[model samples]
Target: MGSLGSRIQGSSRGAEEASEGSCAGTGHGCDCRKRKRSSPCQCDSEAEEEDSLLNTPRRKKLKSTSKYIYQTLFLNGENSDIQICALGQEWNLHKVYLCQSGYFSSMFSGSWKESSMTTIELEIPDQNIDTEALQVAFGSLYRDDVLIKPSRVISILAAACMLQLDGLIQQCGETMKETISVKTVCSYYSSAGMYGLDSVTKKCLEWLLNNLMTHQNVELMKELGVAVMEQLVQSSDLFVMQVEMDVYTALKKWMFLQLCPSWNGPIKQLLNDADSWICKRRTELGEEEAFLSTEQGAPFTPVFRQVRLQYIINDLASARILERDNILPHDWLSAVYKLQWFAMLRTEHDNDTGPQEANKEEFDLNSMRCGRKLAKDGDYCWRWTGFNFGFDLLVTYTNRFIVFKRNTLSQPCGGSVSLQPRRHIAYRLRLASFDSSGKLVCSRSTGYQLLTLEKDQEYVVMNLDSRLLAFPLYVCCNFLYTSPASGRRADAPEPESSAHSVS
Candidate 1:
């Protein structure tokens, strides 16, 4: 019985050792020994199959979570709520909840729910960003209350245009058009022509051209004038024609009435042809004349003449004189003689008075009596006749001849007076000076007239010369002096000469 018990105990220990060895190899007790000896350990296969099944589904779920986190955190943050509307029905409630809750929190440490709620409080829905808003914005900007810069304004305008805000777009367009100068507008048009803003550029061009035309800045227009003309011509041939017609009408009316020159047949034909061309172009473009003047036979009042003259004077002053020493005869005459002649003619036409009494006065070479005495100190009183178109001949003691015109004469009466040649003369006279004691030491006519000599005051002749003939004078004074007899002065001083001459 002791021998049998020992065998049983050793067999039990052997079984335990085998079990430990099998467990070390397969991590499970070997079942092949209990079953058929041909069967291998099937437990390893079963364990591997179970692990594959479990890990496959878990790996897929993990990948899906990663994708959700990437889209929610990286992609969704870049898009606004309005953009998200494009996702369609694929954006289910479960997906949204997962994205806003789990994936958003995991990736960004925040949820869309909180962000949406915060943004909703600040945003106003259905706010019309039209003219009213633009007006308010512009008013604030104009008053310098707004801090937005020009570049930012452009950006806002682009956004407004893209969003189909018509009033805001138009307002911005107009503002941009008005604020940009012609030079800058041209530059921008050339360089930034491909920015999908051709309409804005066109508006800017139109505004600049319109303002230039209205202001009539001819010199400025001439400087950049060709470009504007080209633009207008290209826009609508009719527009060019209409502008030409208006210009022709204005020029024709001015030539006939204000300029004192009749419109010749050739000039009329040229103007008519210009008008017809303009009309034809306009008709093709279905456009009407913009500048419609009411008066046809009205006089031309050159409001811009002063401005034009100033520009011309400045230009002339700055330019180099081609022939300084000896000026051309025509140039000198144009500058001096022609203007004097015109002034003389204008005076004659304006005055309605008769010629001065020629044979009335007593002439003393030493003591001359004027038809109307302007000044008399003791024995000699300087006298002058009224201004006249015809020349008055005065003979003195020496070989001196004085030619006076009607325009140079002064009316003894006080009122508005015109410098008619019949009343005045373009003459330079020499006046003789006397001592305070009324002693005439010598007789002469100074090249310059003494301004202190009153209309009726008399001064002893000091000097005289023929060089005075070279000087040209325009009679501009309207003051008239009379003798004590109320008769017009015959020998009034010649009209003062200006330092500069105009044509």
Candidate 2:
């Protein structure tokens, strides 16, 4: 019995080996070598061997936690429990992910009707919120990070704000802050204000303050509204070119563009065209009253009020331009003239040597803003026009150093210089250089400081690195040569009008 069992086992083992070898075509038991390559027997053997190579399944990498959730849950909507209908589109969303949003969380958790409903319809009233924005806003709930283009930030911000997605809103603010430029600054400012993003709003304002005069653009001017212009004009930080008169000129061009948005012309001709347009309008209206007093110019009265007429009227040529343009009311210029006369008398006789202390409030609101553009790296010595309370300030850029000299006697100056033993002036010095796209390449500021200078005294305000200096650099300085004892000059009258200006 034992011998018979051994024989059977041996026979079974041989049979198994023979079958394996025949299928593999690697043993004498196989006849595939003699068969034609295209024959079914050889093909079958080859197929068996090929199938064996891939018999074990390939192992695929698992999706990441965030990606898996975003794809399977947000995009694919594989196991969605809620249907969101908005902007003529539908989203199969999960309540767990929807709970991440304050808007949806409130609807689902509160006693609202949507809490019990499977299909909820959303009403979107914000024009900035569109379907594409909604898609990004929704996908953000399922993903760890989102890619937002600067162009689409406004719309996404609107959607995120509507949906009360704090994270997405913050991300949008960061993106807007990082991408601020001449083109998007105005829109971003308005949108940031609308969306309650004060940081972005402040960032936009800084960009505008730095570039408004340094890099003037016709389109940017057209986009600036009255409120924004008022803030910029009133700010002591405004970078003025040459003198206060240029600021007025820029405002004139900006106002003209604001009125005539369709007028597309080169920047060099903007001033001439604006002047011609105003002249024609004055002729057509047949009125000698200042444009700000008329119905057409009344809307811009606030913006014009922010202009330091006292500084502009100090220059004879600037005063003549103001009178000729008739854009400002006669009463406005008359009051400024009277104020200047009194200021001049005080400075000349009363021994008033500018501000005694640094009153930042007084300096910011009333400082004389002036700037100069350095076309190249070289020695530059110049002074802005107009009498600055006998503080004839001279700015010098030499050897990569900016020096301020109280021009009392060292050099011959066009304007009168104070001979006081000591004079105090609160000033903020800002230097900036821009690229071709009007983006700041390098910048520095002295913030706001009070400096004391005696006759012929010189102070080095800035020491710059030669390598950091760029051509066409702009140097903006705000100087407060005088500050009131307390409140605004009580004698100076505040004017009010009851009309609107369109142009």
Candidate 3:
């Protein structure tokens, strides 16, 4: 009986040992084999087995919801509920998606005839809209986003405007503003005006104001219409090089191009060709009258009239050009000459120390525009040549700082200089640099402001960062030396030059 009991005890011990070994291997106190089939096992072998189940060949991801809808409903026209025809093209569309457009929404929601019709024919009166533009516009209703090429943005904008797609219209405006260049500025300006895109129009004007002189282009000059040219020339913001005379010269070249559109010549030869053309015309007509008074040149008179004749006649060389060109009416030159004579008398006799107040209107109409170009970074000191009503302003660039010096006795200057203790002048200064494509890379401006300067005193107009300083930098300025006289100095003596003295 003792041997049997010992054997039973040994058997019991073996069974318990085997159970412990199984539990240790499974990492669970309970037997994994006895657990439900769906239960988790904490063994490494089970983890490996589960990992094997997950391993499979890679596959392309499913397209997004918006993309799938655009392809099936827009591209394939599958199960389309509506058809839109415009610009001789048809688009299979759905009412639910088309409702996103205000035009279609109104048609579907209102009692319009299109609401009951399965196919609607749209009347696109806008010439800018085309078949491709219609396709993109219709597809945009179904897609999350649309890709607009800069070249095609105007067309899309027209389509969007007709369909009352405000979102797409805004996008097109932003694109036009971003892509404004010499190539696109004129067209964009015209289109913006036609489409009521005031922001885009203003942007184009600002670009032209900055680049018209700084980055002169022959093609661009040819594209400018008379109205646009007049607007630019009359604006005080026009970037003029050297003096107001240069503005007149630029206009002359532009007018020549406008008349002779087929004359595709390099810019360097443009001026001579223009002069010869005018001379030949004058000879052919056998008319000694001013060119602006003639029928052929009459169209350009408005643009030419914007030239500040007072400033042009101040310089002897510029005056000579004015007489030689015979472009202005004799009455125009006479009036300006008489006006300048009285102003000069005030400067010489009346102790008229420059303008004290801003006088924005006077400044805008008569300010002297001048500029310089720096091909490379270096010290530059110069003065624009002309009698500035005794306000001899000297401009200098050094150490990336632009300094304006009111010259009284520091330098030997040909023009007269003001001697008043404190002479006040209204002026604006602009600086800019461009990249290879004539894109403005860096720019700075000091809007019109009144500045007081003493004799030999210098003021820092601008302090530029070295990093932002670019070669071929352009500096433009507008200066109003004296206020508009309330009335001609009552007893002012006549100047040596007569009213008819221009010739």
Writing each residue's lDDT as its tens digit, candidate 3 over 1-503 gives: 57998999999998887754454555455566576546655674676776787895668766778888988889999998889888678888899988888988999999888899999998888999999999888888887689899899889988988888888989889999989999999999999998889999999998898889878899999999999989999999887887888888899899899999999878999999999998887777665688888888899988988889889898998899888788888889888888887787666666566787768888888888889999999999999988888888889999989999998986565445667677878999988888765678888898888988988899999899898878889999999887666554533564545222100
- Over 4 Å off, model 2: 1-63, 410-415, 485-503
Arranged by lDDT with the best first, the candidates are 2, 3, 1
Q: After superposition, how far is residue 165 of candidate 1 from its true place, in Å?
A: 1.6
State the lDDT of candidate 1 residue by residue for 349-399, as single tens digits: 323232222221211110111121113222221223322223232222223
Residue 181 in model 1: lDDT: 53
Backbone clashes counted, model 3 = 0
lDDT of each: 0.33, 0.85, 0.84
Off-target runs (Cα >4 Å) in candidate 3 are 1-62, 410-415, 487-503
Which window of ten consecutive residues has the lowest lDDT sum in model 1?
A: 362-371
TM-score of 1: 0.19
For residues 1-503, what per-residue lDDT tens digits would candidate 2 score against the true structure?
56998999999998887554455544435566565555667557567888998796788756787788998999999989999999899999999989999998898888998899989999999999999999999999998889999999999999999999999999999999989988899999999999999999998988888888878899899999999999998888787887889889998999899889999989999999999999988787665677888787999999999999889988888888898888888888888888787677556555556776768887888888888999988999998998677787888999999999988776465456667688888889988898765668888899989888888889999999888878889998888886563354735433334111211
Q: Candidate 3: worst 10 consecutive residues by lDDT? A: 494-503
Question: lDDT for model 1, on a 0 to 1 scale?
Answer: 0.33
